[model samples]
Target: MRAKLFILIFVCCAAALLFPSMPGTDSLKTVFRLTDEPNEVIVRGMSGSALTINISFGDEEVEQLIRELQAPYPLLLLDMEWAERYPEIVQLIKKRNIPTGLLGHAGMNYEQNLPLLNEQLEKYEDFFGTKPLWFRTSDEQFPYTLRNALWDIEVNALGSSVRWHTGEPPPVIEGEIISLPHHREQRITLTDFRKLTETRKNKSLEDVLFNMSIKTKKMPE
Candidate 1:
């Protein structure tokens, strides 16, 4: 009876340790267990004044992004399929030193597609000559299991703070990460994006992220 009681206590303690009561604050904290819900850590260490646009790679924005945008490349989210389809464009993006991130499937059943992520990462490295550190799973349910897997590989799961589509008023530049879905039929064009940038000014993903790193270090322990 004592042994059984001890085992029960141990299990309860373990559970409490692993799953503490959700904090009331909005601070960035890592999830320790499997969860299908979106968590704050997806946008961990994010705090900035300048807005960042993550462009979903498409043919329409190629000229605008490469030549028009000029310096401080906007973040481009690319996948293996798109890379294969437009190798020359990919090369152009590379030559221009545009910041690119790995784009995941629309609705990935991670249990089955987990291995596929690894394969894509390998191909991404081969094509880009560097492993992707930023990953975007477009409006998909990102399970904690997958997030943990990504974190294990030193890759961060990114969340878009605002999503802007064409024909709508520009999104207010309040969030750190703003998404411009160029891949969609009705998406924000470079013309629209430039006007928005002119209003508030935008920063590169690298610059914003580097700022985040500095903010995290200075945070109170």
Candidate 2:
């Protein structure tokens, strides 16, 4: 009982720090466990898979990738540098309602880079005429200062792998922010990812995920 109580306390603290303005551990943990199961009732309600790609550098490839995906893609533009290269692409993303977020690439040092993050957030809003809903740093760990800053701005936090090395569950809520893992528990190969993205238009995300599950089980580790 003591161990369970400690875990509950730890989860609540972690959730509060990592995801601000979100619900408590009881609800969040349920969601985390739900996300862990692919065919669970919670997952099957919508029956779909989603992907997020963080853009660390600038190039025409970024534009091409956006052109392929219509919406629900959290494109984390690393810096303001991409503004010049993909101005129109950014505009297109806004037009399509594709979720745009910021990435802390330059070490994402909250103390030192806070100014940079603020500047880019303003510029992005100006560029797209809308603010971003999410903010993600390069690393999985969310610093105290950064987490509070994101909460203040009402931007959600998106980071971490779906599962931790110690086998802890993913974070479900913070405040207005959500602590999400980019990958799922069921690992898929690079080839599977490529196939899913490349043929996204031709197939629904659920179909790809289902197919990938089958392919992965057949492969020898």
Candidate 3:
């Protein structure tokens, strides 16, 4: 059975703070200073959903995943350091045209400082030729300061609207980006290499994502 899902889209609000300007972001501070809050609105809606999975890359089964998850089930997130160490992975990713994003900082709340955020952005942008279209903090967090920094760089990310991997709590429509949360009774995830090597699944993960995108589009906002 496909579960019902909600997509939450919200805004980023910037406020008064003294932040150090970074080399590539001289205009960022002034960009947010002009507005006390985001001019965007949050929209909530429901959808008939698919049994799709959105997996983040971990430090395992890199080659196997590359062989399997091309095109439809594209790679999503990888820690910046992993991307640096295995630069060849990026080449594979480019060939597949997979959309990948940077995982967040090592610890909590550094997005308040422009230079600190700049460092993270510079890492991926240098390689990918653009800032990330998606991002996630240590946890699936979206603190106000983090939102401000992400908004400055035109980054859009999705976070679990409720708990990290649970599928119960309704999404709270108050954050920087649109999050479409799907419910699957927890399995060993696609990122779980040990489990993938063990179990045999009937449906391909690619079909799940494709069906999901279609179903979600049909849902009225």
Candidate 4:
């Protein structure tokens, strides 16, 4: 009797310990997150005018290769600092009526330089006849400083969000800024981009503008 009692007690203790509570399994359903949902906001172009392949010097081969790209595929995404040094390139591009975009490296802590940035924007407009379509602190990192800097700039001054290396979508802001997908190089054939632009015409600019404003509000402030 004692042996049976001992066996029962052991079994009861083991069961209690093993099944302390009903095992709850977490749902592992993965969902695709939309970074850029198709909305009323129709960004005008498809192919980025040019891929921001290189911003610094010493890549002569790359620059040459970029120049060899077909006409209308003007290599416009250039470094602001590089443009300052090679103003001739800017002039040449403008003379050709190529759509160029400038990426400025105002640094991550760029909030303090808003005034300077605004002045620079005016200078660009004066030189290029229009402000660049995009501006970001850096090409790789997206910290709070970059966000603050972007917020400080006039809504219409910049074009697209800076490409982040993290593959994370940029914090949406008011305007038709192209938020590139992560790891996706901003390079595309003129033919392909042209197709994208053609399709975009189906949407009105006002719709695109409204969507952009809505997206900006959704971003974490």
Best by lDDT: 1
lDDT of each: 0.57, 0.44, 0.42, 0.39
**In model 3, how large is the Cα lDDT of residue 164?**
27
Q: Write model 3 residue lDDT over 1-221, tens digit each, in one string.
A: 12221120001112222333333232111222211233221111123211122333443455456667633343255556667877777777767766565666532556355476677778888788877655655455455656656667666433432232333323333221222211122322334432322232212222332232211111111
Work out the TM-score per prediction: 0.68, 0.50, 0.50, 0.42
Cα shift from native, residue 89, model 1 (Å)? 0.7
lDDT of 1 by residue, 108-147 (tens): 5664578877887898888977677667776534666676
Global Cα RMSD, each model? 13.0, 13.8, 13.3, 22.6
How does model 2 fare in lDDT? 0.44
The TM-score obtained by model 2 is 0.50
lDDT tens digits, residues 1-221, model 4? 23443454455456657766632111100111112321111123222222233343323433443455444332345555566766766665556544454455544444455466666567667776655544433343333444444444422223333332233333433333343221124443334433433432222222343232323212222
By TM-score, is 2 or 3 better? 3
Q: Which candidate is the best by TM-score?
A: 1
Off by over 4 Å in 2: 1-48, 70-78, 106-108, 162-193, 197-221
Q: What is the lDDT of residue 137 in candidate 4?
A: 37
- Candidate 2, residue 35: Cα displacement in angstroms equals 16
Instruction: Report the C-alpha displacement of residue 32, candidate 1, in angstroms.
Output: 19
Q: What 10-residue stretch in candidate 4 is worst by lDDT?
A: 25-34
Q: Is candidate 1 or candidate 2 better by lDDT?
A: 1
Off by over 4 Å in 4: 1-54, 58-63, 71-75, 140-219
